[model samples]
Target chain A: MTEPMFRTPLRRVRGLGAARSGTGHFWHQRVTSVAGVLLTVALIVIVISLLGRSHAAAVQILGSPLIAILMLLFIINTAYHMWLGMQEIILDYVHEDKWKFLALMSNTFFVSVVGLASAFAILKLSFGV
Target chain B: MADYEARTSSGARRPRPISPHLQIYRPMLTMVMSIVHRITGSALYFGMLLLAWWLIAAASGPNAYANVEWFMGSLIGQLILFGYTWALLHHMLGGIRHLVWDTLHGFDPADREWMTVATLVGSIGLTVALWVVGYLAMGGPR
Candidate 1:
């Protein structure tokens, strides 16, 4: 039989490519998603608890250390997870290289702005500022 | 080495083959769920803005909080929030389904359908239950 022309299966799977980050993106996405299963549930409960509370009441509820920490965790986890996801979507659909680069850049900016703002708000509330 | 050098010198890239086009398959629950997973995820991406606004308003003090609260308490706001709730829960369940598959289980044809169904039913049930609890917490039937 003739020798196989393509790389071996084991060879193909090993090592990072030109991007220097093989599987890192996929791995981090899954890790964050696993954390998200619990965070999302906690988030829903927190929102439900605040349903009809007054401003001061909502503040009081969110001010507690436990709740504030959970909120911060959820915000950070979600921001990262969604950024990874949207990057995948943009890479897949936005075929034009110029537009694809622009989309990816915008995704980073948007997630960072929203995430930092939300985190700041939580910190302010937690510190009673 | 010479062939490699020549190819590199050319600096031209050939188009790569892509997966089969989507039109080949009839719609199925698995396919539908996969699409819904992406859609809900995309929706929740924007939904973060709502969340950010809520937190920022709270931080900015009572007057800002009250204005945000009033809008959130309005009919349109409630409708938007209701949709957001369902999307959030649905995407979370979908993520769990993915996590399970990543473990190399739940791939049976019947099992795949069941998980998709569970994702759908569970999200709707949780959304309704949470809203019911919210209404109840608001001091019952209005």
Candidate 2:
């Protein structure tokens, strides 16, 4: 067969032209979205169970290593999924170029801070530190 | 480069036309509600961080836990909690509606309309029920 006429770097990458790399983000967001749906229900049940209990009782529940680990995972995944969803909303509605950049940056920063703080809290609680 | 010219001349990289956007379609109640579900779902992400903080602080010590309690007992905290509860209910009902749709049911226009309406009403109902339960748990209006 004759050699392919076009050898541009962009053309060499499979599925990289015109279609964009959005499919990965889209699929990831959906996967995490479904995960968040399940996690949220479990979280709500946990919180409701804790309600009306004294602060000390709540502490005992959270101090369990198992609960701490689950909370950490939930926080991280939830923040990441939220960030992805908000990015889509910002990209859709924020028309100004500068504002869009700022929005994206702030979104990333907000989610990161939330995730870090939550993880730190869980670790401190689990370790009694 | 030769490849660049070849691709360009061959019209293999022409700008693709974009389809019309949301402006072309009339707004509907279901569409608005669906968007709201996403907005509230996003809000809960940040809200859960607060919950995690409270739980952690409670686990940490009396001092740390007291601080969280003080904040959550304040007027502002109650207001925030109210909003959080409503958001939770809204997102929960919205999720149930999505699960129904996933099962390939509720496709009819009338069913879709009823589902949307039910979610809104169910959210409000659940919020009210939770508050009532909370009130009773707190000794019922003193």
Candidate 3:
């Protein structure tokens, strides 16, 4: 009926910390993961459907605001989710502390850069900028 | 100076276990597949940048866009694009597998192995199927 004495308090809280904000990241990752799964399949379908099309036709389809918006969402979520997953991989495998920190920082920066750049591109194409 | 001071202060800091580390543990297919998923995911990050570049260039003008079109048409560029296509498919399948696991299922030893195998085979199959479609649509000429 009683808890084991040897079980440390830290062990109990290893995954359940007081810091709740981290859960937001975890939840968002899962949400985006689901979104990415659907979007990736849709993307493949769209690409295949567009196959054998002329350049102008391809551009016209991609230029639609609806397609632009979906592409924007897909790019941003994919980049962010990839960054989150890569961060975990680096933390798990990179033994050098300094290198791990650098990897984490670089991953964050790279994801943000790619996400922003992709959004910009989509906007440029959609709005003729 | 600040780093030096911090280093001196932290010099006495106990060496912590950085990571349990893959070397310390026996290699498993699941672990290898997990790492591969990450590696491919990272590669797709850059691949998206390529997509962005193409989009932006196409929006710019004929001359500006032609540069990207030319590169993508080149043999070397096609090779890279093929690799990215496979990476994207691999990572996407791996992600779906993780999502299935998160639904409080598929953690059984046999199920886990089957999921891993499925991820691998599915990714390769999807990539090849898409590339075949792409090739056929693009025409027989390389």
Candidate 4:
């Protein structure tokens, strides 16, 4: 669809194009990326601490409230960022409409599965369930 | 330019160029890093599976967690983990570079190339240093 010629000055400033939400993806990708910078460091430290430790040791470390919360935030942010990134890739490479639709659908599904699985794991450990 | 091309009078769309002539051009460091950024980003998608598996195993109790630890301690798994570590670092550095550019600075060609080189080198260096620390934390030389 074509953009309206009489778009408001603010709309022009926002530059949201025909989709009316083009830049939101780009903006949020950046937001998540900044979060990832911090979250990933926390993740690396946690993983390193877990190395050479047994299951019980791992549980003792991860089951802490602060670590669990950080992990949940990491999972959520990473999953959203991943979905955005893969959606862009699929849109670019999967030119056929049907295949593109399938890829996009599976992208969300995959991200959700990974995110939920990880989140569930963290919660299970944290709650001792 | 491709999108700007008009359709034929009969309304048939024509093929269009999609990117800079990548095949014909000499590879620049920035160009290489641009591609690497995408590659590392994609690699992280698969790496996330490893993470999910680890978490799920940990949650499932000792036996399941032991299986995961066995695999992760194997040579192949270590190699995979090493590659994943490098990819994560490279992608994170690349994202920082992009963030810098979004501020509308660092567009100087020389500065761009320098940042790209730094990203490549820094990712490798950080990955190695992190692993060293990790090994030491594990009591070393195992």
Comparing 1 and 3 on lDDT, the stronger one: 1
Encode model 4's per-residue lDDT on A35-118: one tens digit a residue: 999999999989988888989989988989999999999999999999999999898878877798999999999999999999
- Tens digit per residue, CA lDDT, model 4, B51-101: 999999999999999999899889999999999999999999999999999
DockQ of each: 0.45, 0.19, 0.38, 0.57
Poorest 10 consecutive residues by lDDT, candidate 1 chain A: A7-16
TM-score of each: 0.88, 0.74, 0.78, 0.89
Candidate 2: regions farther than 4 A off: A1-22, B1-27, B99-105, B135-142
| Tens-digit lDDT string for candidate 2 (A14-79) | 665565673677667767767776777666666666666677777777667877767777787788
The residue-by-residue lDDT of candidate 2 on B103-141, one tens digit each, is: 799989999999999999988888888777765765666
Per-candidate total of colliding backbone pairs: 0, 0, 0, 0
Off by over 4 Å in 4: A1-9, A13-16, B1-20
Docking class of 4: medium
Share of native interface contacts present in candidate 4: 0.80
How big is the positional error of residue B88 in model 3, measured in Å on the Cα after superposition? 1.1
Q: Write the per-residue lDDT of candidate 3 for residues B37-67, one digit (tens) a residue.
A: 8789778866877877876766666666677
Stronger candidate by TM-score (2 vs 3) = 3
